[model samples]
Target: MMVDEHENHTIDTVISLLDILIIIQIEDDPIIGIVLVALLKTVTKDRLIRILLILLVITLGEVSEIKS
Candidate 1:
């Protein structure tokens, strides 16, 4: 599926922010961090606010998977 520009931007923004957080909290591979962030946005439809909240949840998740 294709995402619109707005959605793409939202995903990009969320992933960037998540990348920063992961850098601070974890010392894992950056590629894994990015993939995790992308997975979070995938389930959130690229909504900016939802992405923000998902960041929090994913950061706190034991498994790094997004939930509704």
Candidate 2:
């Protein structure tokens, strides 16, 4: 669960970008799309997948707790 400084920064950046893009038309903004694509490329395919998997696990855990 320990994410290093780089990973932590990346996560924060991704979240911030998502917040911005969600508030508007993401497809309409080419700048945001370019920025997001750049960020995703830097995060790499494996790391992106890892982050999504971690989120999935956390979501499932919360769901199970709610069911209990």
Candidate 3:
């Protein structure tokens, strides 16, 4: 069970890295990040994807709030 949790945490970290890349590219107005995130969304499902989505949403909300 601990091993499984560790694996999930590693996967979440990878997803968060991807999301960070997306956020960076979005900030720079780059096209590739948009394409990459779209492709990832199409390929992933359930737990990992949902976690990434929630992280993305929260990060975006925080950035927007900061900007405002």
Candidate 4:
């Protein structure tokens, strides 16, 4: 039926939008990570190296998860 076809089309459009959003997020993650690292480096001194490493690890993990 026409209504069924329209419904399917709507669903497909929504799914495509979600896919695009996910792709954008994946691409932006690294930029965000870099910015965070830069901010941390500027805001903190050598004393926070451990904190920076931990943050970097967590950010990398999130990126990997998004990729997979």
**Cα RMSD to the true fold for all candidates:** 8.0, 12.6, 9.3, 17.1
Q: Which pairs in model 4 have colliding backbones? A: none
lDDT of 3 at 53: 72
**Model 2 lDDT per residue over 1-68, tens place:** 55688787887687555435433434456686456546655665565664564455446546776796
Ranking by TM-score: 3, 4, 1, 2
Candidate 4 local distance difference test against the native: 0.55
Alpha-carbon TM-score of each model against the true structure: 0.39, 0.37, 0.42, 0.40
Native-to-model Cα distance after best TM-score fit, residue 58 in candidate 3, in Å: 19
Model 1 over residues 1-68: C-alpha lDDT tens digits?
A: 35687778777776677656764544556676666666665766636675576567556754654452
Predictions in order: lDDT: 0.63, 0.56, 0.68, 0.55
Between 2 and 4, whose TM-score is larger? Answer: 4
Point out where model 4 deviates above 4 Å. 28-68
Worst 10 residues of 2 by lDDT: 18-27
C-alpha lDDT of residue 29 in model 1: 61
Task: State the displacement of the C-alpha of residue 57, model 4, in Å, after optimal TM-score superposition.
Answer: 20
Candidate 3 stretches with Cα past 4 Å from truth are 28-68
Q: Ranking by lDDT, best first?
A: 3, 1, 2, 4
Count of clashes in candidate 3: 0
Q: Which scores greater on TM-score, model 1 or model 4?
A: 4
TM-score of the candidate numbered 2?
0.37
**Candidate 4 lDDT by residue in tens digits, 1-68:** 99989977875565445334333545556566456445554765543463545445566667898798
